[model samples]
Target chain A: MNTSVNIAGVCFKNPVTTASGTFGSGKEYSEFFDLGRLGAVTVKGVATTEWKGNNCPRIAETYGGMLNSVGLQNPGVDYFIKNDIPFLRKYDTKIIVNICGHTVSEYCEVTERLSDEDIDLFELNISCPNVSAGGITFGTDAKMAETVVSEVKKYAKKPLIVKLTPNVTDITEIARAVVSGGADAVSLINTLKGMKIDINTRKAFLANKFGGLSGPAVKPVALRMVYEVNKAVDVPIIGMGGISNTEDALEFIMAGATMISVGTANFANPYATVEIVDGIKEYMEKNNIKDLSEIRGIIE
Target chain B: MKKFIFAEVVEIKHMIEDIYDMYVYAPEIAKNAKPGQFAEIYTGLGEAILPRPISFCEIIKEKGLIRFCFRVVGKGTKHFSEMKKGDKLRLLGPLGNGFEIPDAPQKSIVIGGGIGIPPLLELCKHLKGEVHVFLGTREEPILVEDFEKTGAIVHVCTENGCTGYHGYAITLVDELNIPADMIYSCGPKIMLKIVSDWAKKKNIRAQVSMEERMACGIGVCCGCAIKIQKKGEDDWHSLKVCKDGPVFWNDEVIW
Candidate 1:
């Protein structure tokens, strides 16, 4: 009956939380479901300054999934501390702030700014595929990943969860690097870099030419990476990527993730997070499983 | 507490080639629905992950019906065309900030092109002032009859000269020398830019409903962002098309 998960010293009421960028500070989804029902609300990425994001055609539909190059458009960390934090505080859930930037200083600056704010955790987004500079660069390179994580760890007051990008030669190598640099936990895999071309227009469907593919299409790869990283690192893993239902979440938990974040699935079903929460409870009751730890990483 | 619900399709009529008019019995949406508001309809197409945002073409409150006229632009819309009467579609809406009609204008100009014309009809039906409707299309017009029923003075333009004016809707607006105290428009981005520019020149107050590739018809995704001048500020701000507005004041838009 105990679904609470502990990552580092932070205790989530339940193992269910929304993936960053997918849930916009919990204000938007708060209409569909109560924020109090969620274990944590992972907000959109915030940078040093407001970002304009990318050009038009930012989203496209593919088989069983979708692609987006939103470029982490946000209103900056100051705005989050002022507007979004107060709004989210009204809810009875933990708040995990996702921080994105073009440089290590930008990431550290956001962390330092939010250090005084009423937040629970920090999901350092070094894996955004849309932005050309600090995003994918810090994620894909083991050395840069280690340096950024270590530097941000210095300023981040809350537990740091380094979100890893899947576009790499060895996902586990980068996973090990972040944990070595003092990361409390790890979340993976941020969308896979992919492209879609409009047949009639004879051009890229997305304005950015390449976008991160999420949803059912990337589930297998995300699972493989989570499994690989779980074996490679000692830190707790938050498995995500195409988790649409309770079964998908259980698969991630059994594959060695302490918790799972629902990303693209929230688009398909607005009440997806709540549904997964209820479904997991039902699954545990039906299976006569008392603790989530019993099934955590049970899959060999 | 979920905004999404299943609405039973009461009727579906083929208005023109690849264009159809659909009415769904959704009392909840009808009760609070306004002009320029759109609904994200689940197209039942298994491959299509996101819902299609269709503007409310007509809101029949007494009967609890909402009409939408859509063109078969892609696979998602094509699936909407295939749905039969009595079918049910899951829709989330009355979403976004809709058009704000001023108290009593001297006259209102409602300009619309292609699929964008549908939402303007509901606007025309609500306005108390003198309404002037200008519709432009590629070849055939979709809702000419509906626009006429709104009692608005209608002007039609077809690019092939198959109907009224032989060019864009602005051509007729120019030749006829129509005067407007207020304006509302929705259409292709290029046409909106042109109309937005025209409104700026004449010092007329105008509102436009913008469109973009949207994932969550609600504001979360940040997928449908449009550049807008922050209120009382010269700097541009990224506004979500699904949340802050699909309808924005002309001056606010960074056209």
Candidate 2:
């Protein structure tokens, strides 16, 4: 029988959480199901500077999944900390707020402000492509990744979990760069950027022309990254990509993820958040395992 | 908030040349369904990633069924068109707001252009007396025969001069000069606008259902906001089409 393990001293009741932007503050799903049942809920992405997000046609649907180019259209960090945090604190489950920044200083600034709050953990979103810079830069380079993690880690009084973007050349290098820079844990596989075109109209289906693909379509890629990063890092890994079923969630745990987050699948089925949490418990019971830690990194 | 019960396709009736009548067995929503509310149905083949939003044409709760009429346009509707008897579709419905007809109208003139005809079909059931239905299409193929089952005085306009009263629908309405106290219309946006203008000029009451790029279908996404001219307000205000409408007073819409 295994018990819960500490991640940088932040205690998680369980190991299941919804990915950022996938779960809308947990209130919407609460109408259909109870939110407190889940171990954690990662709210929508929050950027250092306010963003309006992309233009129209920001979303599209494909087989077993959907694409979203919300482009992190969130109220600025100050608003999230001041207004959103109070309501979020009421939930029994832990709050692991996801934060994104355009520049390295912005990351530090947001982290420093968050350091004094009674927050649980801060997940750094170095993964998002910086739109104003005219190129998808931040996640691709090791030096920049290390710089971002190190700076944010300095002011992040809470545990720091770096979310890795999959658009990089080598997933392991980016993971190693952040881990070496004093990050406590890391989340793998933010959305993979993609685009689709309409042949008849000869135009892009999404207004932004590109979106991050999630759901069953990207599960294999997400698994590979989780498996790779689990091998390369000492920190805990929060794995997510196209998780719609119990078997898919188990795959991430077996691949060495300490916890997992569900994204695109929630849209098709709103009750998926707590449903997956129950699923994790069912798996542990069936396997005769007393603790979920026994399953992590056990994959050959 | 209703449970999603199984809805079987009892019969796939080809009403018009390209249009189909997919009769379903949706017990709960149908039993409590109201006119103007729509349902989201999974195209039998899963060709459409999201369920196609179709307004309920007729809800016969005694038989635990509702009917939807759709013209084959894109992949989803075309695949749904191929469905046959005994096919089951997972449907969630009786969604969005419907038109609230006035307490009294001397003569009701219902205008339906192409796909818009199906939604107004159910209105005839709730309304009293004989209604004058003005139906229009580009040609005879898109015109349906089942519309006459309502027993209303029907008029049609075909662009190709192959149908009754050949010409634009507005022309037929203007020429007939029917003394309509209220007009409920649904069609392509342009047609609805013209009908609204005509109703405005004629001093008749009109209600319109608008369509837009919908995401959640229920609401919440904020994707479907239409500008509505509010009474005494200087600026046009935004109203959620999915929740506040799909149905609105004809004059309130900014067009």
Candidate 3:
């Protein structure tokens, strides 16, 4: 009956938390349900400075998913510490801040600024594909990913969980690299890069011409990556990419995700996170499963 | 307050070739919904994950019903068109800041283009004083009768010259030269820009509803961002159209 998970000495009440950028500091979704219901609330990416993001037409719907090139628009760490941290402190859940930057120093600057904040963890985002620099650039390369993680680790007082991009040729190699460079835990897979064209206009659908694809369409690939990364790295895996319902949640857990994040599905169903949380408990009870650890990575 | 509800389809009507009117029985949404606000209508298909954001055409509070008049633009809208009475679909609604109604009745001019004409019908019903409505369409016009029923002077314009006015609706508004205390509009970005410019020239305060490609109809996704400059501010900031406003004052928009 135990659903709690411990990631690098930080225990989440449950294994359910919102994916960054999708929940927006849990303000909009807070209208649907209580923020305390979930184990943790992962806020949007916070950069060293305010990001204007890309132009309009940033969102485009694909077959079983959606594409977005928001470019990690944020109000910076100072704004987040001043505004978001106080708001999240009212909740019972743990606070996991997702940090985004354009350079190694920029990443460390945010980490250093937030070191004294009352947050629980730092989700270093090197996987955002929409940005022109510093995001997926460091994520796709092992040496760069290792260097960023090790550099930011020096400034981050809280346990750092590096988010990995799926655009890399070998996801496990990057996973091993981050762990080697002092990443306490790892989360994967960030959106897969894809594009869509408007047939009538004969132009790209998204303003950025390409966007990170996330939703049910990317579930199978994400599950495979999570399983592979689980085997390759010793750190706990926070699996994501296209998780909507309880069945999807259980699959990722079986595939070796210590915790799961609800992403694009939140747009389709605002109550997706809480539903999966409740659904997971209901599933464990119905099957007479005592603890989540019994089934964690049971697939292999 | 906004809510998520499974609204039952009470009625459906095909008004024109691609446009259709759907009335849903949702007492909470009907009671809370205001003109210019929209609802995220979820398509039950797994393939299409995002909901279609449809604005309120009418809020029938007495009957606890809300009407959504939309055209079949893509896969999601097409699914809504095919829905029959008694079918229920998930809807998250009363989203975004609606149009602001002045306390004192003032002379107002409301303009809409194509599918954007629907939300104006509800705005006209709520507005007071001298109201002039200019509706523009590519070919044939719909909802002219509905606007006329609201006792507003309805002017129809078509691009093909097959209707009331020969040219665009804004051109007809210019030709009429009607004096107005305020102007309101919703349509294509190009048309909205023109309306904003025209209102500025006349020194009349104006509010225009905007549309952009959206993912999460709520504020979280930051998908539908519009550049807006607040009063007394030198720089324009990216404001979410889904949360900050689908309706904004013409002067505030960075266009």
| Candidate maximizing DockQ | 3
Stretches of candidate 2 above 4 Å error? Answer: A1-8, A46-53, A73-91, A100-119, A124-137, A141-158, A180-183, B43-49, B72-79, B82-84, B100-113, B123-134, B141-155, B165-255
Docking class of 3: high
Minimal lDDT window, size 10, model 3 chain B: B1-10
Superior candidate under DockQ, 2 versus 3: 3
How many clashing pairs does model 2 include? Answer: 1
Colliding pairs, model 1: A1-A290
- lDDT (Cα, tens digit) per residue for candidate 3, span B1-255: 346799999999898989999999988888888999999899978888899999999999999999999999889999999999999988988888999999799999999999999999999999999999999999999899999999999999999999799899999999899999999999999999999999999999899999998898888898999999999998989999998999999999999
- Which residue pairs in model 3 clash with each other? A1-A290
On residues B1-255, what C-alpha lDDT tens digit does candidate 1 reach at each position? Answer: 557779998999888888998999999999889999989898655577778899999999999999999999888888888789999999988888899987775698889988899999999888877888999999997688889898899999998889888899977776776788988999998888888888888889889999999898888888888989967896887889998989998888887
Against the native complex, each candidate's DockQ, computed on alpha carbons, is 0.75, 0.20, 0.80
Alpha carbon lDDT at A190, candidate 2: 88
- lDDT by residue (A1-300, candidate 2, tens digit) is 443445778777777788887675665566566666777878776667666556556667666555666567666778788876786777777888887777778778878877887678888887764255412366678888888788888888899888899998899999999899988999888888888787888998777787777777889999999999999888999999988767888899999998889876665555666678777778788889998777888988
**Model 1 ranges with Cα > 4 A deviation:** none
Best by lDDT: 3
Candidate 2 iRMSD in angstroms? 3.9
- The digit string of per-residue lDDT tens for model 1 on A1-300 reads 888899989888889999998988988788777899888999999999999899878999899899999999998877888899999999999998999999999999999998988899999998999998999899999999999999999999999999999999999999999999889999999999999999999999999999999998899999989999988998999999999899999999999999899999888888889999999999999999999999988877
For model 2, what is the alpha-carbon lDDT of residue A71?
A: 66
Candidate 2, residues B99-146: lDDT per residue as tens digits? Answer: 776566458888888788888888776766668888888877343455
